[model samples]
Each structure stands twice: as C-alpha cells, then as structure tokens.
Target: MSWGLAVLQHALRQPGCPLCRLQREAEARYLENLLWENVNDPATREQWAAGLGFCARHAWQLQRLEARRYGDGLGNAILYEDLLQRVIPVLEAMAREPAMDPLPLHRRLAHVLRLPRSGDPEGIPGLQGRARCRVCRLGEETARAYAEWLVEGLGDAEVRARYAASDGLCLPHLRMTLICARTRAPQALADLAGDAVRRLQRLLGALREYIRKHDWNYRHEPMSPEERRSWIRVVAFFVGEGEGDGSLDDRGG
Candidate 1:
C-alpha cells in the first residue's frame, strides 16, 4: 500500500464519536511534536518535559514509549521519578483529610511505593519504595532534576547512542513502541515487529564496532538492495493491514 493510501485508511478508521475523534487528533498532534521537535530548543524542551510529566498511568505509557526508542531501562527510571513527584502533593493532601475510607488514595500511594528502588546512580531509591509519605516534597524536587536531565540528556547524541546500544527491546517495550507510534504513523506500526528485528540487527552491528574501538565511535552504514526491499515489504504490510488486523491492532499499532 502507498503511504498516502495508508494514511487515508488510518483516518477513515478513526473513531466516529466526535469527542473520541477530537481527543485522538489532539493526541496525534502532541505525539508528532514530541517525535519531531528538537530536544535542544529551550521552549520545546520545557514543553516536552511538562507534557510528559504525567500521572502514574500516563507516565507508564510515556516510559514505554521511551523504552522502545532508547532500549535501556533509563526511561522507566526517569518516568518513575516523575510520577513519584506528582503523586506526593496529592498524597500529602489526602493525609490531611479526615481518615475515612482512603482506599482510592491509598491505591495511588501504593503505586508510587511499588516502583523499583536501588542505590545505583541510575535509580531513585528515596521515592521508589518509600512506605511513608514524608519524602513527597523531596520527590518533587528530584523529579524537577529529572526533567532537567530529560531536556539535557536526550539532546546529547552520545547519550542517545549509548541508550540505543543497550539491548534493543523486550516484548513489552516493543508493544509499547507500536501503540505509541500508531497514531503518528499507523502504516509503520502495522509491520512493527519486523522493523524491530531490523533495528536490532543494525544496533548489534554498531555495538560490535564500538566494542572493538574502545571509544564512542559513530559511522553510517549503507543498506544493501535486499535489505531495503525487505524493509519496504514490511512497511507495506503495516500500511495495508488496516485497523483490527491481527498484528497491527492486537500487538500494538
């Protein structure tokens, strides 16, 4: 299927309900900006940070998106910090409330406490597994620091390269990538697994070279005709599969 036809099909498949359609459109716009905007731009960086610093559910979704692109678990840690900070105030306010049936708030608090915590530089131990709510303010500050890191870290080509160098993705991350990418490029998602396989191959090759060099080495490699053809075939499958098609719908995009 041609890209144009694929796009048209995707648009046609959009929900007929006015509110749902509008929400989907807005989400698409947001995702386009997130993927295409320069992370180095101050305003764009700030916007991205604020937009992504979501509640637990949305933060989990964002973390999944980052996991697919970066491969390493770094995005998970970053998002966990963001959620912890955001939940702190809400938890504190709840604490002040008369202690009647706090089940709903308790569930939220539990989610925050369940996050993986470690003393490793990469981990956020204070916020990750805390039983008490006292560290809520500290978590917020830590989240701000993480937001700054997100702005700075992603802009560093070396950091991005290092992230990509980690294991390409697990099954869960791959699924997250496909779902997040669908609104932006439905056709591309239709054949996501194949794309993932190819990407992993490319990264593996790069990793081999970087290991041999013992330095942060970068180079561009040319794809052979066969490789190009194979990729195009995968893309075509994604585009033509449409919504509710097993691979495109069930797995991710």
Candidate 2:
C-alpha cells in the first residue's frame, strides 16, 4: 500500500474524523517544512508575498509551531518583517494622499440608505493578496486527494472494513468522497454514505441521551463517553476539525 493509504488505514482505528485529522497533519507538515527548510527560499518567499504571509490562523500557527518546535520565532519574524516592509510604504503613501472631504449630511444619509455613493469613494487600500493561503490550498488539495483515495480504497473489503471500524468521514469529507466516487468509482459510494448515516444516527442518539441525562429527572443516570463528547463532536463535524480550533502534535498539532 502507498504510505498515505497505510497511514490512513491506521488512522481508521483512532477517534474523531480521519479526514480532519489527516488534513491537520498535512497542514502542520507544510508549516514545519516551511520553518525548517524553505523560510528563506526565494520562491517560497514569493508565494508568501502573494498570500501576504498566510491567513491569520495559519500566520499565528506558523509562529506558534516555530516557537514550540524550535524554541524560537526567527522564521516568523523574517516572513512578517518582509510583509511589514511591503505594507509600511503603502501606508505612508496612503497617509500622503489627499483625503477627500466628508460628504454632506444629506449625502451621508443617502449613502446609508443605499443610494448612490458620493466623493468617488475608494476601496480599502494596500496590496490585496489575491492568492489564497498556501496552507489552506494545500489542506484542500490533500483532503480531496484523500477523499478520492478513500472512495477508491473502499473497493477493497479490507479497506472498507478498516473504514467501518472508525467514526467515519466528516460531512465535508463525505461530500468530497461522494463526488469523487460518483465520477470515478460509483460502486461503493453507498457503503461510505451508509456508514455516514449510521454514524450520524449514533451521534444524534448520543446527543439526545446527553440532553436527556441533563434533565433533573435523568441526571442520576450515568453519562457514557460518547454522550460526554457528542456536543463537541457534532460541532467538530459541522464546522470541520481544525478550521478554527487549536492543537499540538501528530494527532492534532
């Protein structure tokens, strides 16, 4: 088996969503690689410039991982210093530009009321980073590729069994997996879909049990582990794994 698939199969034995876990690992790997090897590479810097040095989540993640892993923030400093240098000049130029006079009160009221704008109002300034975050892009590409692999992999009984042993794919990953399976391998999509449905049923049941047990009538009943985590697990599945949450290490990071 390919290394990724092997790793994915192993992940099937673990908790939470495999796709989410792998995606986080993929992003962390990219960030770690950047800090260790490519922080100063011209092409890497060019990509960073285009993205304006990462999205806020990843920008800080880069710094945090740099400090946590390396005991320093030198790499982040280099990247942001370059970005700040590019931005300060733009800010200074904006400061130098003549400011337009405020609109009349009636015109301001009109603008607020959604009438035509006045004074040739300009857009927010400074360099617009049209390029999406490289880390986000990589995460997406990795997830989709994994989704495809998962659908294709499901053809094997062993692979399907391995999948059945876990919490199954998240909604986003399931959609991507279904899409890939529909176009490329339609035979086994139902299995993955059924798995998702059954998992959802259990998740819903756990959530309901959790709510029921919260009532004073049922408060004496013991909470199962699944019941305990169903609320956050539901949120994780809905919002995706690491999109906003933080983490640390191979399991999360």
Candidate 3:
C-alpha cells in the first residue's frame, strides 16, 4: 500500500502518532523551560507578561507539571503579570459582546475557571468548585491541528475523499473543524463537507459487506486472535492514512 494509505490505517488504529507525541512533549518542555527562565530573568519575564498567557487548559497543564517537578507555589506567582495582561483583555472583549442567552457563555467561562490544577491530589475548584474538563481542551486543540493540516495538505479532491470516509464528527469537534477552515474559500469548505459525506456512505457499505462475509459477531466474534488483530490493523491503516505526497508539508501557515 502507498504511504498515504498506510497513514490512514494508522490513524484509525492509533489515534495519536509519534510526531504528535513528540510535538506535545517538546511543547510541554519548552513551556516549562520558559517559565523557569522567566523566574530568573527580568527581560524574559516582561516579554512573557506582554504576550498572551496560557489559555485556561494550558495553565492547568503547566501548574500540574510544575507541582510534580517542584512542590512549591513559587513558580505560579511569577506568572501573575502574564495572567493579568492576557486574561484582562479577554474578559474585556467578552464584556463588549451583545447580550444573548447567557447560559452557554456562562457555562464555557465557568468551565475555564474550573480547570483542574495540575498535580492537585484533590481537583482544583472551578469558578465555584465545578471541575474544568481537560478533554474538551485536548479535543479542540487536536481538531484545530487536524483541520489546519487538512487545509494545507490535501487538494479539493483528496479532501473530499477523506471527509466522505470519516465518521461524522462529534458536534464539538465539528465546530472546531469548521473554525479551522474559517479562512478557506467558501467553495472549498462546501466541497470538503460534501466529499466527506459521500465517503462515509461508501465506508458504511464496505463495513456491512465485511461483516457479512466474516459472520463476525458485533459483541462476540469467532475469529482467531491473530486474524482479529490483522483485521484491526487493516482498518486502522485505511482510516488513519494520509496522502503520501509531501503536499502536507507544503500547505498553509
């Protein structure tokens, strides 16, 4: 099979890839080091304070990591200026938005505040003790990355094909995906959604055939362990596969 096909299978089988894993670890380390350096250096500290501080989720992640590596709350205090500079603008902008149903907005903000502090044996209190969910943060980031990758890598044709093959995304992910593509041409966005729908239809048919031919039980299959494993590998290969051309590397900023 082509490298592209191989990637599809891998994605379906293993949701995370080595590149993504390395990137996450590297990002974590970089952020950690930045925090450490800022503590000792006034110039670096000022720059960080001027820039947007970590989003709620990232802040929690950093907090957790710091607590694990060093048990003091000292590091967090150094970030006070950074937090004030970054978060104040967001709060100000939010204040200016026209009034609507406040519940959803309230919930989202509350969620951010409630995010768990890293390494807290008992979860950190949310706005008022509600726990902020990390899963949503991770999902949004991953979806954003994927959407950005797709926009950059695949042409209209390939994008359509992949969309069709994909399982309809969860609502939250769908929103994130759409946001990622917000800068693209409207025609391109429509093409992508249309193609994905078509691919999904075809995939459903193929799955049905495979199930019938194998007489596989959904709940309890009769296949040998090796056979089952092989089948799973095949599925992962197809679903996770990416186009092999260096196109992915060349696409957008």
Query: Which should have the higher TM-score, number 1 or number 3?
Result: 3
What Cα-based lDDT does every candidate model obtain? Answer: 0.40, 0.75, 0.46
TM-score of 1: 0.25
Cα error of candidate 2 at position 50, Å: 0.8
TM-scores vs. true structure, each candidate: 0.25, 0.84, 0.35
Give the distance in Å from residue 137's predicted Cα in candidate 1 to where it truly belongs: 30
Could you give candidate 3's per-residue lDDT for residues 1-253 as a string of tens digits?
A: 4444344434423232222322344456655775576565765454444333455656677778778888866777667644564455435545776473334444454465432232233421222213222333343454456555555434445544554444334334344445666687565556656654664455455555546557545545443433433333234334431222222132221
- Residue 5's lDDT in candidate 1: 31
Clash list (residue pairs), candidate 1:
190-238
Q: Specify the highest-lDDT model's number.
A: 2
Model 3 / residue 192 / CA error / Å:
4.0
- lDDT (10s digit) by residue, model 1, range 1-253: 4443333234324322111222234443443344445334555443433333444433444455556666655535643455557557545756687573454444544475433222334533333333322122223333333323322332345533443443223343345445555555554454445545776576456445544444434235544433433333243233322222332223321
Model 3: residues >4 Å from true position, as ranges? 1-30, 41-44, 47-56, 71-74, 80-146, 156-188, 194-253
Q: How far is candidate 3 from the true structure (C-alpha RMSD, Å)?
A: 13.1
Model 2: lDDT to the true structure: 0.75
Rank candidates, lDDT, best first.
2, 3, 1
Q: After superposition, how far is residue 151 of candidate 1 from its true place, in Å?
A: 40
Question: At residue 155, what lDDT does model 1 achieve?
Answer: 37
